[model samples]
Target: MTDLPFDPIQLMREHPEKMHIPGGLLTKQGPQDYVGGVPAITGTLFFNDAHTAEVREAICACFDEYEVIAKAHLTWLWRAEPPEGPDKFVYEKAPSMRAMIKRMNENDLVSFTYVSGKQPHDAGDWEFQVFGRRGWEAKMIVRGTSALRFTMPLLHVEKNPAAFQAMFVSFAKRLKALHGYGGQGLVLSAPRESDNQPFEAYLANMLNGLDVGEPVGATRSAHLGIKTVSWLTAVNHKMIEKIGGLSAIRSELPMDWFALYDYGAGLVVQAGPKPEGAPADQPKPARLVLPNMLFKEVRAPKVSLHYASKEGEPRLIGWGAEQWLQRFDVPEDEVQAYKARLLDEPKLTKATTLPDRL
Candidate 1:
């Protein structure tokens, strides 16, 4: 698909509430101006034709009985996968397909509402009209397999997290019974603060820490990470001083460096003394420590960090090694020598002081 021009700045100027912009710069607006009337809860569930009728009935019944839902709709999605293999799933017109699906959803929702006895009182009031007509679309798209999607316009229940959780849990339970014992399902809902933007965009802004008047997302996050490490180091020094210096703490804790390795953009040092008991051949359990604060934060698809547990096998950490490296300030040249000493060289002597400063 051709890349359409997307000017976030222009969007922010026109639709201040939708984009992340400063409050001071915005017009003097009241609560009603920015109030997103009702939250839309939308998600997809995958199941075969065996449970289709029962699932649809349960969903419709749930919407009908639940007074909290102002309007709701459920539909099936037909997805087409690449015939070559499961590896390359990217379609040529993927973006266009998404845009088309969104438009079709809006149009279909309007027709569905009218047929279902929830016609809007004021057609001129675009906001109110659109609210009742917000739902997911049923369409064939290139990528993945077929699934069912449900969209619900939640009433005042959006303001209360506990109530929303309970509602979804009950809804899930009812669907689970119809889908049978081990069927897969998921519930998606936007937070109360999210102002009617695409759910993906809202989540992206949140993870990048971009809110009103805040610094531009990723850059701000990187700066804050550096500051955090500096602050923590200063605090560590002060605490050492208060407790009669590093020597005193070291005597009690007795930590020893085990191994060091260059992980992504920074270095990771395995620290802490070997665990007590067990077989001699067993590897020591040490905490993975980041030792560089200036490393560039890496955010990529399907990349993460794996760390061994104290008891069980290794577990995956969501953020990658590069992102984790942003929490320290170790020098580049010292990394190789540190690794050599910890892994190749024999133990020299035990000292009652902290590891050398970065």
Candidate 2:
């Protein structure tokens, strides 16, 4: 058996509670406890016929050498050779370990298996059983079309986020080194709690705080007046599009902020207070309300604007209300009239001026 790169047994021996199991096997299996709060780190790898043998060998060798005892549940899929017959694939689950191992050794059958170090398993269809018995558990399932998804549950990531992040980075790097893999090597974590929000949403919130330097609990509320909201929404939407959606933004910015509204006309975001020790110059939030018509119109390519700054400008500078009205194709006289009307409104005046520094 080949040696594993990491010694899971040593890690488990040192921290049994993290794994949600007693220190030794001698402890009888008492009533099972709920491990709901833990976050699970997951990813998928794609393999083809050329790398199948090597992939299987590496997984089996790692488990065999690590002293990680695994309960294997095997499956086999057989497809008829093409042409003469319809290319139908038949699936079969082995009734016993002996039968599964026998099929695996046969070499002709396309086999997949779930291996775990713990018992009383009740994983869903897409869940995989990871082998290492550490403070966490792992699961892998075969996603048809030669894709394999692996899930590793981190018992207390919220308590030791730095450690959890480090583990995920290391694991992702190792997995990417496997044969026949391509793409950027995806990895995702489930929500820490039962909230059903997509991972992308969670990621977007984090990015708002880290990348955009937004304040926590600060929001682009309706009070900012419609003009400012319209302009900021347009600019932010452009930035988000350039960055490739909210989830991609999260990768670049890992701070935490709640995105009350991320799609459709505009975004309404709120985040917790600034993290302790954040830099003093971080951008602060300004209240704004995006106009529905502007949001819709800016989606087209024809609309554009630029921020202009002048010496002693009110620390805020942007297109004037008249310029924006013109951009909306308002009549020249009407644009002037609207600008005159806005000048008398303090909130509208403040909204039109873009912050000198964002």
Candidate 3:
């Protein structure tokens, strides 16, 4: 249970509040979801900025989900243990997503990191690392020696208004050209905040670097040194306007499972899955619509669409409802066949009892 007593570092599936884990963010059975789901919304902390201290200040102000448990070797690169202090981030205690959001009602944070090889060793002796301290299941682990570390306070939703929107537009067009169409819109969740950056951009800038550092400009935070977990709860419309808009978007959106959630700073969509082995642009990720993970003790979401609504807005509907769906990672043609056998029906009704999310 979210508020009920439980261990922090234990498997989340064991917790009542953490059930229905967002796709990709969790170590699920299959590929992560990308077509319109809260899993697409990612909150990041930028480590490196034009200004550094302001960035660190901004980062410390909000949620500290990362506790430096102990520095040691994980499977591949480096991993940092949670800091041994009350000031460090703790999911169950203070500095929660809600508390940090309250502290950062008007500001955001950034941090800087650098990776370098050990000076005296054979160039691979030791490496510096920065862990995103992302939620338990999925995480962001960066390694280097020295330079600028950008702690990204990023939420991966649909396309970024400015850049990603254009990329999605192009992908949508290519799909149209191929004569492919679908009922559900695209859904994407990035472990790192900037995963929202077009896949091409990532390949070009971060991976391939043909246009190295091309995306440097987009990583800059709006309020330097300012921090707020609430930024994640900011109005999606405003964030879309600042970043760009939906005019250029072309990804298919299926009406049945599609639902939109404005989680401050961004809007998230609950989308259907795409055909298997499709390109990044055409028929985006297929996903079963899942509800935003909630805390059992708190009645409202810590960062929610309603929390961002304008003052004195009309009565709300379709919010914080308790419905869940079982996602399938099968082929498009087989999805219906599989559903018929598993659910034994084409649609869900009040009688269907779903599993509780961990």
Pick by TM-score: which candidate is best? Answer: 2
Give per-residue lDDT, candidate 3, residue 115. Answer: 15
lDDT of 2 by residue, 15-129 (tens): 4234332111111221223222112333332222312444444434432322221123212221222212222222233243223333342123333334222222212111231
RMSD of each: 21.7, 22.1, 20.6
Model 2 has an lDDT value of 0.25
* TM-score against native, each model: 0.24, 0.25, 0.24
The candidate with the higher lDDT, 1 or 3, is 1
Model 3, residue 165: C-alpha shift (Å): 20
Once fitted onto the true fold, the runs of candidate 1 whose alpha carbons sit more than 4 angstroms away are 1-44, 66-68, 71-155, 177-358
Tens digit of lDDT per residue, candidate 1, span 59-148? 444444443343232211112221122211122212322232234322232111111111211111011100111222222211111122
Report the C-alpha lDDT of model 3 over 1-358, residue by residue, as the tens digit. Answer: 0121333223221331232222222122222333111111122222222123333333333212221211221111221232222322212232332243234312232111211112111111111222222222111112111111111111211122222222222222221110111111112221221222232121211111011111122122212211111111112343334333443111222224332333233333323221111122332123321111110111112111111212222211123211100111234465444333323213322221112100
CA lDDT of every candidate: 0.24, 0.25, 0.22
